[model samples]
Target: MSRLEVYDLEHNYVTTLANAYNVGYSKEENQLWDASFQLPYDDPQLKYCRPLRFIKIYDNEDEYIGEFRIWPSEKKKSMSDRQVKIELLDCLHTLTDSVLFGYYQLNNYKTDYVFNWLLNKQKNKRWIPGRVDFQRGFSYAWENENGLVDALFSIPKPFDEDWIMERDTTVYPWKISLVKPQTEVTARIIEGYNLKEFTVKESPQKLVNRVYALGDGEGVNQLTFKTINNGKAYVEDTFSQEEYGLIEYIWTDRRFKDKASQKASTEGMLRNWKKLQYTWEITALDLMKLANRPSNLAINQGREIKANELRLGKVIELITEDNEPIQFRILKESKSDIDDGKANIQLTLGNVIGNTGTTIADVERQQEINTNYANGATNIVPYIFDREADFSNPVEFKFFVDDDVRNVNTCELTVDTSHFRATSKGNTSSPQTVSSSTSSAGGASVQSATSSAGGASVQSATSSAGGSSTQTSSANGSHRHRMFSPGDLIGPLPETRYVAYGGGFVATGSPNDIYTAEAADNHTHTVNIPAHTHNVSINIPAHTHSVSINIPAHTHQVSITIPGHTHEIIYGIFEYANLPSKLKIEVDGNIVPIDSTSFERFDVVPYLSKDEDGKATRGRHTIKITPSDLARIEVQLILRVFIQSQLGGEF
Candidate 1:
């Protein structure tokens, strides 16, 4: 018989039990797979079944079925039989506790960046992903979701179904490629021919034709299909209205930026309401298990059958009542063991909408709406920078000076004469002279002379009383002339002309900008400027960068323009708009402060603007920000008005 194997967190073999009875694993669409079995009251390896350890289930062939997570100390004991029953949870359930920290204001996030970021960042070791495929193209925006599961479900099924958020059966167990509804499988569930028993169900519970699709704007400005649909804001399906009177549904998708797309979506939704939803519950006998096996009861073939052909996520042909042919896929499966060895597997088969991500149309929304909205906005994001972001302190704006010297405008410059002296290499603006001559009977005493002007000369002549006398009188000295003596002034001082934006610096290219000037006057004076703000430090409490990160336990203050209108506000409580957790929002005029649980909980109502009727009350409301020591929180408040008031007419 197939056995149950236990592995530690590291996947090292811990224990194996071939003796477990009534063992089977079942799966539900979009939910984690579950399994349960009874062990003898005195089993020794029961200790290995604690939380964090993993359990693997296999069929009699011992081929891989799937892996499940264990919860701490969940065991049921029947005193009369002394058998203990333990239930198993799939690895995805751990996401229920793990959280993405912070509030996000997502504009248009790509399909893969959303997944990779959630699975690999700012989370505890509660769960880890084995593999993640990077998907290009932005698919989601301005939305909020709860657990990782709910957040993932909010994403539309990728065109490549393999890229949907799903887990593997064994290899790379946490990767998304689904295991079933696969085109490669050849499986059939035929009436009486193979099905042990079957129940057919048809319901109009989720059927709809009149879709009231609403998008981003509020009040009369709300984007709707009315303009393009002649006179009706809502499009009607003739078939559904004929068969079921009228089924009305409201879809508020804030992601839509315009009306034309809403028209196409409404028409698409009209097409799906043609028929009532259909489902089939069956207890299909395991045909492969009884082909040769004789030891196990033909009725008890469940234990011997892995149901490989009818595995979850696989598509199968079903010949129903009256030999009517229809295609269905296994969506949900339940197991039971009756007396000795007779085991039965009940399968919930449905032809629901689905991609290849999971077999039972697990990717479909539980609610009725235009599935087209699931194809989230695919417009190329112009940019992803948020106006309000959580930024690290001391942000730096660099001013890079180029290697080559920049040109300056040719102009005259002047400064306080007391703080400057007029002098040049060869000449000065004004010339001053110094000349000296001595006539004496005796030879002239040793004398030294210097001139502040160039062109000063010396002449030799015989002095009176037969003593030689020299006379020097000229315009000034030669090229070595200077107006000020070296001792008269202290210079060679570096230029301290402060360059700033407004006065001399041009933020953008324009005439008279200092950075591009051809020439600058070289006068010895200071370019004294008023204190400037461009190079000063500033503290912005609520800010963020292109890369979003988790903030510590902190509060952020914000003031946003919230219009008073009737609308629906859905915000993610994971990290940001897409993922936010442990968040708090307090309006200035309101008394009660609202806080969501840390990373794991979400409360959609009362955060933004809302009225008593679940729509927002008309009026401006201020969102108050408190002070704290963590990253500032930014909320992408999306207001969606579902009804139009300006029409002023009855339908």
Candidate 2:
């Protein structure tokens, strides 16, 4: 089982929570570690727990999960006999509580500059921001954003790298810095194994085959694709239209100021949104502790991965429905209860670790693989198919190799002559010799021969073969002059001519101070802006409040109705001291009593489970806080409700 250690607002170790119930935590909007726990009555260490308390949770292996802090009004205690609940937010929440003022721009700044900038803007006077003596080489630019935390997180990474938040509460001013997320260690989340219930949601509800892409300006001046798309402001996918009809959408991206960019983004959106897609909502078991592994399963090398290695943002393998392994990053994780001493974890897998093939399915498997591979599949680790060796004489094969992330097409191999010479190896033959086209009557095997030319006689000697020697002479003595030259005689060099030096247009002065673009006619110049995206937000001024629920302990059950909308909760623990031998406390119709022990006090922790969907239905649920009157017990039940407007939701 995991344990929670609490500390004073100053971070001085106070007490180790001996008991808690309805314990759960999740990663959401901020991706910060905010945990919830319940106690029957507030523990003396946290009698009126509000905020500013430090807490840390660890598993059975004593490995750190995360560090958290209790902000103002985070604690709820049932006055003596009632239920008490407390929650702690990550120490990194300090930035979220702070906001930046005025417009600020940094051209080429490091991570330290961001940290110090945030430290200076933070309004939390109670805790001094930590110092950053080091910085990352990556430079990021920021224009304006009141949310300093989100602004810092929005920093662009150099490559496919990621930025992460860290904190060290060991010192007075917590040591914090922005560093790259580490994925050095990872565990496998496979089907029929550690992976449990999961939902593969594939829907085409948002499919749009036609898009009216809009950018920049407003109304009449809005940049569009007309100039680039044959005088058309909208783009469409003919193939998608043929299948899904003409589902249209208006894609507005203010980042693009020109028609070409807007048009490009519009076409891209059309292509992407033209088809159905799948989203995975998976629930994986967090069996991080070695003891949690089931001894029955025969785990093999590389398969028996320790669950402890499953950290947020770390890439891990998840076996898909086809039993094919897929690596995806963990975007969100929530732990509700300890099932058989193992935490029940629900995870939202995001970003494929490797190429998951471009297309999800096709009429055929190989065709699907080929098509997706052609489109763009990544990190396949060099593989080939349909290339058999020594099969056909002239074989055709297809292979894939990493070349600037492009896939080359099929290639053929063969040796060719006018007609088929050799069909197989070792079938070649040599050619015979033949006579030349020009030959004299002195043939082969002729030992001697004689010839006469120009009134001269020639004799030939032989050695049992034809070998001739001939001589001829002719006198045609008509010879001419060998060489001659005419020196300096090109009409006397055209009679030297010269004109007086007339200095044409010479000046040494600066160009006119006022200048404008000169063009043949009136035309619009393309205004270029770097390719980027804009984030939309609604400013909801920051605020805080407190919840006080005081109900006395009774023998019967009392109920509290948690509204249906976006509502979830964490119930704390109930501790009773010096209870009589027969005294007991009742919770939700069940009695939770400590095992018989010599200790004078009993720390009672209820085992509460969340609905499979990780929510409470819209209705009244019993929160039984009954203790035997004769026994005289004090129960602290902590309830932390995460409410989103009229609807309640998970924390």
Candidate 3:
């Protein structure tokens, strides 16, 4: 037989009230236990008792079974019988009312560390406990507001790491441990004697072979743990081409932000599924023959054996009637009233192999062991080609142009000169000279008259004869050079030249000026004319004369001669069968605007010439992205080389 004992939260013993019927308590997984008992209205102890008082259950041997706290309630009467229904809650119930407040931050801290910190924090705030045990640790970061329990559970456990919470029997305190599965079963039913009811269920629908994990990346918001290389997905062909069927399971765990960590987690999940593809559920009830034996026991020799070791998180192997063994982990346990201190023990078991979950370390090791390329698959081959290559073929290419390449359409040349010449002259001519001559006939008439007078007088004949002998005389015409001396007035000065006193022409003299000659005109010339008939001959001939001329200082006309030269350049044209409507560009890892002056879409000969190469190299217009955005961007290039091909596409 078992009885209930009452005590205050301070551990002080209290008197037991009468009529303690309906005294059983119920405990649920991860929840508080509630127990109820009835007390007679006439009991005086009820007046002093209050809620929050503790209650303990003891067997006939006075061994403690469990304990709970009193729940506040009002007294009531039923069927003319007055009784006080007192509610009691287990120790875990105390935590439900303790609200966590303020900000808390955990960086790379283990779950156990946080649990201990929470316990200490609550203990400082008047929440007392007998003992506490937490042995598991999880690595993660927690920030912001959350409840104590919420924050504790937020720390994710790797697939392989297992943790459980249960009250220690030896001490009245909570115990959390990284428990393992037991090798043997603590209880069983043989010959179906003590077995009251049993049910078995197998679920194959829950089988899954693939898992995908998602989380927040370092800078990006969302990231997935899918096999990818160079921004493209690398699907596992073998898994998709499975012999049986495809069963993919996608799991989103935002706790992991690192790629390696996310990969490990997904791998762990897949490993877990591969270990146990389906789940088996078994529900059983057992009845005991011996009253003193523990509720948990194994069947043997037709007599019930006590197996007090059975507990949550423990593994058990059951032998069926046909001697087939089935392994299960105890998931749930419950006790129900039958009659007079006897109880029915119900158990729920699941087909979960012990220690089968995958660990992060194990996942990481597996990833290292697996080759990057899938089985029987080759790596991608890159093609490189010049920009002028024929891309008519359907293959992609990495086309590039050199910086020296020029697009003639976008170039201009200019030339300028400073001097030139044309034709002009200034001349001086001499004035014509006029000459006159007079001739005379003479004494020939006197000779003829002398002969007639000869006889008149002999004495006069001598004089007459002399007179008759008088001869006719003539003067010769002569020419003399006109000389210019000092004090000579050279009238009507030429427009650009003047004669000086020394008989030399000057270019700096004033034009059309009259000047007086100096008194130094010492040289003279005479011209004479005779009265004789003379024959005259004149000669005039065309000829050129060499003369010294002076010119004024002036500039020559401007003339320009632009040499014929060419602007050499190379251009690149990019084409894609399916190019993105929009694109982003970065130069030397620096993001630049995608406007007309910088980068833009183009068709036809999309000229990547000297103008475009001014800012970057053109060997291979390599598109580079940060490690974080590798998964976000997907672009591929294919190369083809040809002699001379027209570019006709848009990028």
Top of the candidates by TM-score: 1
| lDDT tens digits by residue: candidate 1, 242-288 | 88888888866544543554555555555555558776788876544
lDDT of 3 by residue, 441-483 (tens): 3322222222221122122222211112233354344434334
Q: Of 2 and 3, which scores higher on TM-score? A: 3
Q: Estimate each model's TM-score.
A: 0.47, 0.41, 0.45
User: What's the CA RMSD of model 2 in angstroms?
Assistant: 53.5
**Candidate 3 whole-model C-alpha lDDT, 0 to 1:** 0.43
User: On residues 430-449, what C-alpha lDDT tens digit does candidate 2 reach at each position?
Assistant: 44344445433322332233
RMSD of every prediction:
38.0, 53.5, 27.2
